[model samples]
Target: MNNKKIFAFVIFISLVVASILLLGKDMFSPYVSFEYAQAHPDKYVQVIGRLGNNVPANTEGKGYTFTMTGESDEQMAAWTAEAKPANFEHAEELVVIGKFSREKNIFVADKVLTKCPSKYKKENN
Candidate 1:
């Protein structure tokens, strides 16, 4: 009777709180500089930089390794387990999501996103 109703209300409130907590977690990590990532290797972060001149050889269907220059002109090696993006070479900007590997001294990227140069071109009137 009254006890049963009280138990049901408590259970419903618990479920609502749990759902909010689970959904509140950040979907995308905040962008961090190369220096900060190097210092905090354990935490996952996103790095935004421009593709550097040196491009590591991409083996048969293997991941690609390349250097990226941060906004502060700091260079860091980034490795992605996934295949290189189609517009990687021509990308003006790159956003790498992953954590830094202290042992390897490189950023192990979970995902790579590219912003092509043409995307910023102004249309001729």
Candidate 2:
């Protein structure tokens, strides 16, 4: 093969590999279940589930505890998570970034995203 052709091929491969590596970060990012999260303490994770059923009230004045339903039938179990300031009860979806406790069956979420559904404008008023 010509030297120029070889050089082009190498450059193309390098670009492809680099782009893939960048996109691969999101593809391989660990989005773990409540159980899996609980097992791996000290690691941040994005947990998706319904906001209800297990979080205990913050008696110590720290956070709110709530249960999240897993996405699968086999893993469809209630997982606990802590939402700080005692106002997480109002969240639409609990996307928690935190770790879990296998023994306690709970997650210590550092951040919470409360999805509040907005009301649409009434037309023809």
Candidate 3:
């Protein structure tokens, strides 16, 4: 092939490689499971799970430590995390960004969001 053809091919391959590298990072991103969180307490993880039941109400004070149950029994694991205030305690879903702590047996979520069922409400109606 001519110099121009070879140059273009190299450029195309470079672009493809760069794109793949960028997208591939997401694939390597750590998935936070209850078991995983327990296994690796220090490594930062992106955890996702259901926000079942309030922290027994009258837990007392702000940001009481709590647990997040995974989706299934197999995935079922618990971690101690400083949850938000009482009003926000009733959150239906939680996505915690933190590391696991085996001794603590808690996720230690740095951030949490309550799933707003209102968002799923039918808008067309």
- Please name the candidate that would achieve the greatest lDDT relative to the true structure: 1
* Candidate 2 per-residue C-alpha lDDT over 51-110 given as tens digits, one digit per residue, 9 for 90 to 100: 654544343345455556666622332333343534456655557665665566567666
| Candidate achieving higher TM-score, 1 or 3 | 1
Clash pairs (backbone) in predicted model 3: 41-100, 79-106, 79-107, 80-106
The parts of candidate 2 lying over 4 Å away from their true place are 1-30, 53-59, 73-87, 121-125
Candidate 1 weakest ten by summed lDDT? 53-62
Please identify model 3 stretches exceeding 4 Å from their true place.
Answer: 1-31, 54-62, 74-87, 123-125
Q: Return the TM-score for each candidate structure.
A: 0.76, 0.50, 0.55
Clashes of each: 0, 3, 4
Residue 10, model 2, lDDT: 100
Candidate 3 local lDDT, 1-125, one digit each (tens): 99999999999999999999887664455666777767777676777776555444224455555555677833333333365544455566666666666665555556655564466677885
Question: lDDT for every model?
Answer: 0.85, 0.60, 0.61
